[model samples]
Target: MTKRPPALVAIVIYKTFSALLLVVMAIALGLTVKKHQLLVDFSESYALEGKLQIIKWTLKEILNLNPKTLQFTSMAVGLYAIVTAIEGIGLWYQKAWAKILVLVLVGISIPPEIFELIRRMSLLKLAVFLVNLAVFWYLLRHSLSTRDDNQLQ
Candidate 1:
């Protein structure tokens, strides 16, 4: 007889994959910040005597900010990414709360998914939406099954 994979194993696999991706994204973002800083340093050096407005615009574009607002936005984005990556890693460990958290988190994303579907209609993004839907479906089914089993016992 062939054996089927356990539901928890599926959850772990999904969570771990997402966690790793988030980690890689976080690292990439960190590298971007470093590169932006290097650009700012170079601009401040010999380029100060050149076209000031163009340099200012270039730096603002690189850092994704205006002159008045500081680069705190980039830091906020990096921190958010790190926090979510940690949450994904936690879910991979099959903590009970993490399961519920993931469910709620994915649930919250559905509205934005709908907006994206309406606006751009990108297939790759649609595929990601579908995958997230499948994950939530599986989690709901698993939770219901567990509840039913407990009631029967």
Candidate 2:
């Protein structure tokens, strides 16, 4: 097997990490369903005393979410996590379809990212947009180069 390019490896790692985080988030959201009081108690115990008011306010807002909404969010996040995992695995194996999949998904997300940035500019949002843009560019260039190489062969 040919050695994988470093950029591709980096992208795979990013995807894997993202997938793991999403999975954790999905599980946490799922578990939060019908557990408002438990979450409140836990937050109260663990949260800093000085920041109790803020913590309480945040907890209250979260606890107010509908159970069904949490369930649906969990399922959506879990599904996206699965897809991300698949993308990582496929990319690690240098699958063409994986490149295309990532390209399409990233391309689709750029608009919403731009909208968010326009709505409220923040360092974090800017950083995410830049990173995603870099990834998209690299993948597109790599994909085209790979296609050319295949054609020549």
Candidate 3:
């Protein structure tokens, strides 16, 4: 077993979350397929008569009994999952291209996140910006160091 790279940790974590998203999307797709059978009975089977009933409400909202939208959403999530899995595996192996790929993705997201913060400041937005900043900086430094090492050889 090889030791994990410190800088790749965040990317790995993100990719892992995307993998979980893939699972959730798959479930949603299945429920959409069986919407008529399962969703109609959602309240009967999963509802509660309490404050946490919000959870049930949310479940119903997400499982909105719309198979078409769910199918489209699931396909998008599946594509994201495939990309994330590749990035995750590549980063795990410390591949140069993975670092570049992550750099580009995170770089592109930064401006949008910044724009979002400008629109509405929140802890979540701040955290996302900071994490992306750190990853971008780490990859930049790593690339420079690797380049220097190559030149010295």
Candidate 4:
């Protein structure tokens, strides 16, 4: 078995975590929509008792969501989450296709990230952009190295 690279492991962990969060959010939102009355009742009770004002606001926001719109949003997030998960798994296995996928996906996003930074520069934004660029570079460089290693063998 090939030893997994630390970078690949880190990417897999990050992607899996993000996918998990998105999936959880989608499920929570779906359930909240399905049990809208329950959430509304709880929110009303909280407001009447003047307890956990923040929760009341949050519940109100959630309760106000249109089920159709919520479903669409949830589905979109779920799909992206699935894609991220697949990429992570592929990277973990050091698949050549995964490297290309990572490079293309990350490369495509570079423009948007740069635009965001140009629109409003922030430390967090810069860090995210740099990390994404690094990931792309890593994938490209490592893929070449692995290809060369295979050829030598």
**Top TM-score model:** 2
- After aligning candidate 3 to the native by TM-score, how far in Å is the CA of 32 from where it should be? 3.7
Against the true structure, what is each candidate's TM-score?
A: 0.64, 0.87, 0.73, 0.73
| TM-score rank order | 2, 4, 3, 1
Model 3, span 27-146: residue lDDT tens? 667566656456657656734556486777776776664767777777777777777788788888889898888788888889999999999999988987997798889888988899
1 versus 4: better lDDT goes to: 4
Give candidate 3's TM-score: 0.73
Give the whole-model CA lDDT for all candidates, comma-separated.
0.67, 0.89, 0.78, 0.82
Weakest 10 consecutive residues of candidate 4 by summed lDDT: 43-52
Q: What C-alpha RMSD separates each model from the true structure? A: 6.3, 2.6, 3.4, 3.3
Question: Which has the better TM-score: candidate 3, or candidate 4?
Answer: 4
Candidate 2 global CA lDDT score: 0.89
Model 3 spans > 4 angstroms off: 1-4, 40-53, 56-60, 63-66
Show model 4 residue runs off by greater than 4 Å.
40-57, 60-64, 117-127, 147-153
- Judged by whole-model lDDT over C-alpha atoms, candidate 1 comes out at 0.67
lDDT against true structure, model 3: 0.78
The TM-score between candidate 1 and the true structure equals 0.64
For candidate 3, the 10 contiguous residues with the lowest summed lDDT are 42-51
lDDT tens digits, residues 9-72, model 2?
Answer: 8889999999999999999888888686688677668555667587678777777787788899
